[model samples]
Target: MDAGAAVLTALCGAESFSAAMATRPWARSPHFFVHYVPVENHQTVLTSPAHTALSTKLSTELPTDSSLESLGVQKLGMVVPKRHARRAVTRVLLRRQIRAAMAQHRCELLPGIWVVRLRAPVDRQAFVSASSESLRIAVKAEVATLLGDVLRRCRSTRHAAQAHAQPAFQQPSTVLSAP
Candidate 1:
């Protein structure tokens, strides 16, 4: 793994993907689905179960090393199901592409658990060889597109939040708080 990917913790254990976390996908590409959810603050992880007991369970069930939930960095995981890729070589190729793509966009992504799941298979006839250069390039391009969209969405959401947080037509803080 490269330095960029080394910094990223990989999500493992079934509990990490349980209902408590990443219940829904945040974005999608032609053959992939991206799921991003902020890991709950450790101090308050079990304080409130937003919907059910699963929230409390999440903390204990998740494996320690693989899940860097409390840290302010991206934790990644990929699901290239056998059903989708079929061949071991194809699955491995897809996984490498996903990791490379994530490493490329890690700096821009929000600190959270990010999963890239293979939802559909590529057209086998189009690229007969399982792990051809064309296939790798195609997967890389699709993943790049997926991450790009996620970045845009995160930026827009952040902007909207900043806009909401500031009061309209407010005097400068220096003047307003003058002694």
Candidate 2:
């Protein structure tokens, strides 16, 4: 893999994802756990459950850059008990689907991390009967919707901040020197 990909893999690795989530901001879905961490130059997205028990302290650091282009998405899945090998395979498939969705909607994102976690009780039958294609489509649609919402909010807030930061201009007064 290339450097960017390698770096991503290392940063968002299963163990690291769990560790980061312990201290970062996160969102959730019925079958997912999501964590986000904004960093300089790039954002880190971590998805994990196996290392959920791990903990980390939150940092107050802000990213150096503030654009939507430096964002990334990490998709993670958990291996369900009893399914053994099938559990592993199913989770990999799920990750691939989520990645595809992220690729399609990446442009709408801002400079931040996005993590997705899929949770559930599982059995051998669940993996064997799962429809990966359908899952991919659903995830992509949701991702697109989320990106739009986030971008909209960011723009509005940015405008408000700029308005508040600038001082209002005063008109110059002209004095007449009539004798």
Candidate 3:
């Protein structure tokens, strides 16, 4: 397997999809919601021959000056429910928009499986034509906004978790004997 695929396998296991789906949604917008699950360790899984081969292949494919260890692999799935989009073309357009938004934020995305699901239908009355340029633009804009919001929320939550994880120092109690 190629280095990219190997990295992906290491970061996202066989059941990553189900795990991602089960995770509490990280963020939500009017039309889209995002679910993410972080990868804790990649080295522990590289003991298998298949994983070793994949890692070697990835290392060779990586740039001579670059380090693959820093690379964060993530799996992504996009969903456009039929209920949300009646037309197949509309669903395809929405998926394309989601992919575009993901690509734009590829570098900034954390190492995790992410699923972008459409929860609501676009306003058909606003754009009468399913394949209109205006519809495409609107979908793309909404997807971008959704992804941005999700990322922001993820960062905030991570910070909150870290804050909570830190030990809080307590002041020693002072007792006055019947004073």
Candidate 4:
């Protein structure tokens, strides 16, 4: 799926958020962190201590990109904690930059549940304004770098998976051209 759709299409339940974060973060920047649980690992991760205790109805609620759903899609969630960004404007700005960065990168991201969290607050004294053009540009550049790192990691793994999927040697059929 396209990055735009991946950003907009799904809402993960609290249970899913907990399970996803249960895994160590896949990537981190100075101010942002990304956590990912690949679709293939969902069975083990989702059924971790939290989900195992949930009732059947609760289990049915899942992100669209989960293994049980359309596994090829990507589900994304963003968290900008109040403790980190005291102003509501700051939280929204962080989320906007994240979405914009994800969309800016054109590569096909690995299928998974993805979450980006704001890990630190910018120095208020440095920017002075809650929403400043300088802050936006800085955030945008940092987020783009963060996503770039993820794509590089995904590319290597994806290539390896593709290599293993296709046989190294195979018989080829030949056709003669008419003279």
Best model number under TM-score? 4
lDDT of each: 0.72, 0.46, 0.66, 0.75
Better of 2 and 3 by TM-score: 3
- For model 3, residues 1-179, the per-residue Cα lDDT tens digits are 23344232222343444456667778888888888766553232222344455354665453321113543666567777898888888888887787767766665566656778788887789878887899998778777777778778767876887789987888999988995
Model 1: clashing residue pairs? none
TM-score of every model? 0.73, 0.46, 0.61, 0.77
Residue-by-residue lDDT tens digits, candidate 2, 56-139: 523343433322233343222232233332455555655665566555544443334455555544344533445455555654
Model 3 regions lying over 4 Å from their true place: 1-15, 41-71, 157-179
Model 4: residues with Cα > 4 Å off, grouped in runs: 1-8, 43-67, 170-179
Better of 2 and 4 by lDDT: 4
Model 1 lDDT, residue 51, Cα: 32
Candidates sorted on lDDT, descending: 4, 1, 3, 2
Q: Which ten residues in a row have the lowest lDDT in candidate 2?
A: 1-10
Please, what are the lDDT tens digits per residue for candidate 4 over residues 114-150?
A: 8888888777888777789998988998998898888
In candidate 2, how many Å is residue 75 off?
A: 11
Give all candidate RMSDs, comma-separated. 6.4, 9.2, 8.8, 4.8
- Model 2: how far residue 98 lies from native, Å: 1.5
lDDT of 1 by residue, 1-179 (tens): 23454356676556555532445778888899887766454213223344345454565464334344446667788888888888899999999888988887777677667878898976788879999999988988888888889989878876787889987886666646658
Question: Where does the lowest 10-residue lDDT sum fall in candidate 3?
Answer: 1-10
Clashing pairs in 3: 3-58
lDDT of candidate 4 at residue 161, scale 0 to 100: 92
